[model samples]
Target: MADNTAAKIEADASEIITSPRVEVGTRGVNRVDTVYASIMDAMSNGEFPESGRLPTETELAQRFGVSRPTVREALSRLRLDGLIASRRGSGSFVLRRPDRNIKRFAPIESLADVQRCFAYRIALESAAAGLAAELRTPRDLDEIARALEHLDRVREQGTLGVDEDLQFHLAIVRASQNIFFVTALEMVGDQMRVAMQLSRSLSLERSKVRREVVQAEHREIVNAIDKGSSVEAAEAMRLHLGNARRRLFEGPQSE
Candidate 1:
């Protein structure tokens, strides 16, 4: 059973970002401003507006009067936060709506938003993975693996694997096939996005070094449910989330 995948919304993240008209901090002046504006505009109207296909790098650059790199950087921020998805050689697309939870955030206060969101999400999603094992389909396995492959690439390349990372989690929830399961997953999507974005500086390899170990745990849970080991599956999920909360939420403070 898989435990990931959020519902899809049709809209472009770039079409609606907002501009504050000034430089913020250590980041570059105009580009960051433009990117942030675009992002905010998009978020202001909701993460994606239904009017257009998710804008391309070139299109965004042209719209903001910045380089494609600037747009890419901005998109990268959204990517880690689970705001956008890209299909190789095709283009990026906005999925879910960025509800008021993310939209109503205060100017300076949004930084911690991600952490809070993830703290909540970890609890919901870890349990979902376990449930999926018993509720998933063979087709679900294929979908989950595809996301996993993308995650592996991000780990190896030592860059943000935001989209892939979210995909993996989303697949798990989808596999669970429980409406409540999926609803729980959506409830935390924005926060999960924030946590993932904030943690981008963390080394994917170093941070996710326990890939095989974590994966082994996943397999246990998966196999348990595949074989109808409900107790085992549920326990596996409990343990998985317990570890994640300790490391991500209550871990030793760093700056």
Candidate 2:
């Protein structure tokens, strides 16, 4: 009986190893999202039963052909979504299967999709900025400043700085200290990255003047937040997003 049990464990491990691999760095999909999707697929198929321990980070890394850090990031997102729980000295365990009805932002594949993404951002981020202005602490300010500095440095180098731009916006969202806002942003992270990439690409084609204008707008938002003027912060964010939307749809003439 013990020999049969040992063989069954080995077979299960082999089945996991033979599972389909996640392709990292795919366009329109981030590494964490890829890993998360793969794990969720496994769960949906009952390959990972509830209350059953998941593969260790090392095992998942090897199986998925990704770095352990990538696996860890995927696991962190899973924990945040309440699909899994981790215990000290033990591996992560499945909690509940993912809800298929959860609304997720689709990839931004066209100009229309880009406009839609910006519309969502304008609504979500403008409110987040106002709340952040009223609720932010010194630590939040420091984080926002650091992200802005990174963005400025990248701009000075004449790079589009899509990642830096995303970081700046994410820092502001974090400053709001609202879990719902943060989670909402996190759910659409890939779409947001794509939108940022396209927006920056368009701005790059214009001139340095356009880039400087964006930087000025960012500074305005930060200043309002630092001053604790919630109304000003919201308006600043709204104006910035509105300008971005115009630039995206109406071209450089709108600038």
Candidate 3:
């Protein structure tokens, strides 16, 4: 009750401070964009994550001395970019992240070379999973949720066509918030796509495997991050990725 009243007052104050009308050719920059930058910076630095809850729209309006509409506009941008998520009654929470890796590769000739490729990647990616737990932003977590949801939908409705094996892991790399890491992973996407198509055909059971287990791996990665355990996150990633690689190489007798 008290929070609501305070919020209303703040909103009203913000409206008064921000004029409704704007000049057709104003030269100055937007104040709301400045507010937006600060809010993003705050999230980027893990301030909101450490605090454990973001301020209400009105609280933010009060803080930035901007209209409620202006603050909403800024938040809306964040929401669209997969940075923040909203709930009806409860406030938003930061999403968990899987570890990621940062390594570039030269073009490979065949699946044999990809074996070493996956081996080297899992090592760094698992550790990255741990860092993601420690450093995941709200946006990062949101992306994870969206990916898992997509995976489930795909699993229920159809397969990732035995070709999109990289979709789920790609989402994980993005969650790591390391641009270099995600780009490095992208480099081998072509080889991975080919390997996946081949692996699926070899192991007819691959498509039938319940995604519940794969989704479970995602949760495990998130759990490690939620607990702030980087070491555990990395080990889990190593084990998970190793399993994936084994399937690729030692998979049911391939041509």
Candidate 4:
């Protein structure tokens, strides 16, 4: 039985090791970031083996058509995000599989786009959250609560939960009962979706304590809105987004 099991494991590893390479482009984009994103998407799509082991640095570099230094830098970022870990003799391995169901949105091409998206969301969503606090009905509160509940459940499953997060924000906007707020969100729906996905992806890569902190931030906004404190709700929303921005771009220490 032991010999048979060993043979099966070897076979599985061999098959996974020979999987197709993912090539990334270099047109007006950061190569390291593009390589990292490509690897992440490949993993999420089950291109990697169930054993969690990753291809060697040389193999990855060749596959991505970039320099070994570029691949190393990309891998370093993945390590910092806690998505993969290195073993002295065994190479690097993935820690978890990203949610496969995530729909492809407009790719976040650069750090500048990330910064601009967060800034726009902070101004737009905070206002909506504040208005919801002042003008929400029980039904509006219920929608927000349901969305929050969905987010918590998905988090427990260790997924990014982008859809649930977006729904929570949309619920608040709906509660505000202002057509303009809803319209504005819809106008940039694709960008907002990508931003939410990126933020949640980072959150998933961090510690459990960090994840809980994000959830707590969501609850704070909900509680303030429930109490009809527009000022408190707006402040909570602004602070939450600010911290999210810091966590993503400025590092966890900044948050």
Candidate number achieving the greatest TM-score relative to the actual structure = 4
Q: Report lDDT (CA) for all predictions.
A: 0.55, 0.74, 0.56, 0.73
lDDT of 4 at 206: 60
Clashes per candidate, residues 3 or more apart or on different chains? 24, 0, 7, 0
For candidate 4, what's the RMSD?
16.4
lDDT of 3 at 197: 55
Q: What is candidate 2's lDDT per residue for 214-234, written digit by digit as tens?
A: 899999999999999877887
- Candidate 1 contains a number of clashing pairs equal to 24
Give the lDDT of residue 163 in candidate 3.
Answer: 37
Give TM per candidate: 0.46, 0.56, 0.49, 0.57
Q: What would the per-residue lDDT of candidate 4 be over residues 1-255, giving only the tens digit for each residue?
A: 334433533454454355334334656556777777787677666787434899999999889778887888777656654557899999889765544433333343343355546656677777788789989999999999999899889878989888888888889988989999899877777777777776777666567888888899999999999999887887788789877765553234333
Clashing pairs in 4: none
Candidate No. with top lDDT: 2
**Candidate 3 local lDDT, 1-255, one digit each (tens):** 334433533453464355343212256656555665566556645577632567998889899877787877666645433456678886654331101110111221233345545644664476467667667878777766666667567567655444334665676677677888788778878766765555444444543453455556766776666576666666677667666554443322221
- Those runs of model 2 whose alpha carbons end farther than 4 Å from true positions after fitting are 1-109, 250-255
Q: Which segments of model 4 are wrong by more than 4 Å?
A: 1-109, 250-255
List the candidate 1 regions with Cα displacement exceeding 4 Å. Answer: 1-115, 204-228, 249-255
- Which is superior by TM-score, 2 or 4? 4
Ranking by lDDT: 2, 4, 3, 1
